[model samples]
Target: MSNIVSVFAQKCADYDEKNVQSAIDSLFAQMGGVAAVVPQNAKVFVKVNLVREMSPEKCGTTHPEVAVAVCKRLLTVTPNVTVGDSCAGMYNKGMLASVYAKCGMTAIEDRTAARLNQNFETGVADVNGKVLGKCEFTSAFLDADVVVNVTKLKTHSFTGYSGAVKNLFGLIPGMVKVEMHSRFPDLTAFCDLLCDVCEFARPKTVLNVIDAVWGMEGDGPTNGKPKFIGHLLASADPYALDAVAVSLFGDPRSMPVLQAAMKRGLLQDDLANIRFDFERWKAKRIDNFDAPPIDHTDFFGNQLAWINRLAKKHMVKRVHPDKTCRGCGKCAMHCPAKAITLVKRKAKVDQRKCIHCYCCQELCPFDAVRFRTSLLYKLARRFSGKRSKNT
Candidate 1:
């Protein structure tokens, strides 16, 4: 298999139909064209990163312009292209419509011949991986003859980085994802399960594309600053794609999912094997890219059990639902551990039952979720003024 990851210079605001489509056309051409991955008259499912009901400009979800551009390209090879994703919450048609409308996915149907995935049906897949044996997935993804993962690049509060591999977590469908978090509270194990899901879906996945034209930098998947990266990336291998994607901001090994993937022999820490314009892309790297404190969370994977406990106790950010919480009950409904409760029309977290999974923080629509570091962690960061260099 070829280890090349294609990179293209583009922007979110480059909404000119010809410019966007040409970039995508060139991107697919770099990897032997859409016809190479997509077969004639085959069913194609374009899985986008619709994390929640966020607009395209937020950089939280996949931009519809990119999705439309990609779907238009895929439609040349197959007329049966559908676009959709299972956001965090209830998995129903009503929820789907709301998310689709808010996230601007409705544009795909208007702009291209592709149809939006109306299939809310969920089914269990026999994913017999080390961490995940069986799990629920959206049937739209499973029933497709070919799957194209179009993901948004973001920094995750819990997982450190969200790229091609982390985007597949959306396939699990709604609140079931919250349950998985409670089941595997440890960062390493959760990331292992992520690897398991990716491996299970890897066979049908033909191409992985990252929307780095604009990406979130701090406290993301949902809430963060949208920075202009002005680039897009594609690869047949998700691992290699992520390895290159993460390198744009930080070390790939620092990402929990990538670390777990390497341990499972799915990827390597070194990027020497991946074929890309290294020096050219390296020049585009953002030196001040705001990223999560991954080093603090790496303690969860330490061999010493006490160190793990210590990290869990103090190193991790504590979830605090502030006064801004609008009593929407979304966090309570989606809390995997059932640790969040609404009292007096306000959300309250039972810390004793809290798994530190940060689901409440991630899915809160009101942006009311606040994370407070412990005194010990603060002191440590104070002493260590700057994070160690990635090299």
Candidate 2:
């Protein structure tokens, strides 16, 4: 296999615009530039992770500055660049447009005369052979000749770390995300399904760029603290890019998505072959990034071979909520699964059906629904904690 990764870290120079752009230009030029990856006549689709309505300043979404810079550079090769994303909740094309405008991308469009598109088409990837059913995706992603994935580096509660691979999961449009969560209720199973989707969607993506200038710590993808890393990463291999990213800020062992990718042999666990100059772009390493407490050995450790089968049989039921859910469901829609329903201008869930997917908790705008488990589960958590301490 070809050594497909290169990293450049020039601390003092990176702060200089001439130096930074030159570095970026050199990297892209080495990787065959936009022309090599994106054909001159091809329609280039820039897929960004605009998961929530948070402004670029929040670090919940990809920074506009990064997107604009890349777009400006790409325009040197091609003008058919379209920036789009399937945002969560309501489709606010204007909101995204505003972000791009703030990031100076809109000026590039005005100056260079390009087009910006939003997610429109509905597509699906079959995951029938895996732990979950087929996942529905936006059509814009499926039809593009050149797909560039731009993701922000952040911590995720469920998957451990959110980077390029996890960002693509947002391609699943609208309420379909909730349905997929319901299918793979557990973390390991869900991560497997995510990797399956990545494998299926691999051909559609040509390049991956991670915005590491400023990232989120603690709870993220949303609801996390912002940590500035002052780094930007790019690669043809999403797995390698993510591997490097996780190493910079978080533990590899704790990331379900990374672990799952390793288990499937989709990525190399060792970073020895990857080529990057750490001295130029390396940020002051952050410590004590918080993530969910999960012992993979206890969860899927022993029967790694049988996780797919075991998940299908014993995976806990989880609850999911859509943007429309205001945490209020009419009495007629009130559900005990803690699966949210609208009742009398209020939203509630059927706690009985909740599988602990934390979907409702994640998507709830009002933060109404939360994980509510039995006392036994709580005690189990305490015992597991004490055991870890003693060990």
Candidate 3:
């Protein structure tokens, strides 16, 4: 219930057999005792950021060691601790098994009383929001007595940034998430959909944790370079935790999802409103953090269709299926807009239909999807950069 977003300095390497058991103790202690937050013998679901099936060292998913540490602590308070996530792709036992094994989440089950979630059932739930009325939700999470949001800090291509709130997006069943993207193509609306999902799940989410020991920098939630931030953050308020996380690399308000959160009064625009050691956390900020190069404007939010098209054609980034594509249909299969197709055994994108959601880039397994910035947009950015420097 505290607005305090606790920032703790801890390294990924520090999560070893010698210290892994108590790795995140200080983080929880700073907010309040870990025991005080979790209910006794409750069905606790530790929903983690398993965006796709990838190795943990890639920094695309939550680190197994960090998940294990949290699971160990939670098991002390609850016998029904489950660590899992509905990763991108199909929602089935086989997909879950593959993702858990590849992401090293299976280690959590091997080491502690916490068991991997085997349930893949999903059902409709009343979202009852401005954009989302009702949507599919993973029953494993919806039925939980308490939910612990364990997310990775990263720069997202579509959302601008990914943190605790965006992490909850995994609760929506796997491939059905692509449909949500199609349903809300506008970034503002998609972000609103995100807010709706979080607001619906907020009552059960007691703790929000971010694994910042190694965070993805560019074109992320998938492909990106791992940057060592050497910190772990936690708060009962997912919005406040995200605000602090976004400040590590850029202005929190600049993120479309965070902007939407503010619009709904779920978060405040001012960072000072949140409780924390401001001086200490500020000193830890990564001044040169590399964010995705795409324009973050919500052109789709514009009412005039022609104006939206014109702006999108000149200012937005374009997705290209490069030579490394291997003629794979992965991008086409997951593209929310269905803008991609197989041509001459290679993937090609229809710019007219493309929604710029970056689902193609995020879900492509071959790492073949690439982005190109518009010439006019580049020139405009150069001019803006010069003006800012002169001022």
Candidate 4:
């Protein structure tokens, strides 16, 4: 028999601490309280999704209210509580200060006794991972007795879904995350690395909470419109938490992160094994969730090289630099394919070199990287719209 994982959900229309506190407390209580995961005087760390230093309205980073709610409950178990995230920046006094200030993390310290993590020092853990044998992580992550992964529920361009599993990528500190994307450009390889990190941390991570109150749609993780989801989801098992979260849309197979986890035997697409009130959650399911278009895979590329290139060019969506490009050169710096370059003081992407991973699109702070579909691909989608909705 598969493990009976329990997940709970509470509708939160806003991020008000008073409104969210009771919901947070009730879900934890229903799931056996924080004591189930944290021991007395244990060091508890809350990992918030601070992808970049953006305002709360952007709905990119985990709201400060979520951190406050988690810390409020965590305090009952242990006084040594810390909340932080490894966003896309240098891990220094300047970087941490900017991210905390912009993303409202400093307020967490003021509201609760929990403090922000100041440790920039990283240590390597021998995961004996399938992809990379070793991984580098912040001391806060490795030293924490119990880690509560609080992630912003959003649509991702590459991974298809960014929930508990996608949130684990933050463990790989700083620009090194960009390096990993460059190393594993393919979604399958990249998700394997994510799963490896998730499996390594799964034992220590006590709980996973997803902030779906305001999830991003379209080009998410950074540049996307915020949609009011009104859901506060949690589970002791991160995979199960993710499994339930991804099912809100059309099909679990549409999301590569969930698909990859299923392929690795890390999780199942269905919640049959997960112990949750499926009937209650049905009422709250998002009917018209606007997820990004899925980039179809070229499985038969090996047969013919020229035909594969032609297929990719006309089929897969391409990332383009729009007028918003500030010539910051940030996109060029981290692009795995080395396809982008500054032209006439504006960033440009060489479609041929691009791999359609959307790393540049996700990492770009300016929302300058826009996705463009080929005319033939657009026509195909028009005709097949009814046949394949999520795809």
Q: Which predicted model would earn the best lDDT?
A: 1
Query: Could you tell me every candidate's TM-score relative to the true structure?
Result: 0.94, 0.76, 0.92, 0.92
lDDT computed for candidate 4: 0.80
Better of 2 and 3 by TM-score: 3
TM-score for candidate 4, residues paired by index: 0.92
Q: Residue by residue across 57-151, what tens digits does model 4's lDDT show?
A: 89888888888998988899899998888887566678889889999988888988999999888899997878877878888899998889999
Return the TM-score for candidate 2, rounded to 2 decimals: 0.76
Per-residue alpha-carbon lDDT of model 2 for 33-92, expressed as tens digits? 767766676677787777655666767777765666667677777777787776554344
Clashes of each: 0, 35, 0, 0
After superposition of all CA atoms, the RMSD between model 3 and the true structure is: 3.1
Evaluated against the true structure, the overall lDDT of model 2 is 0.62
Q: For residues 26-83, what per-residue lDDT tens digits would candidate 1 score against the true structure?
A: 7887777778878898899999999888888889988888899999989998999999
Query: For model 4, what is the error of residue 290's alpha carbon versus the real structure, in angstroms, after optimal superposition?
Result: 0.7
In order, the Cα lDDT scores of the candidates are 0.82, 0.62, 0.81, 0.80
Best by TM-score: 1
Ranking the candidates on lDDT from highest down gives 1, 3, 4, 2
Please give the lDDT score for candidate 3: 0.81
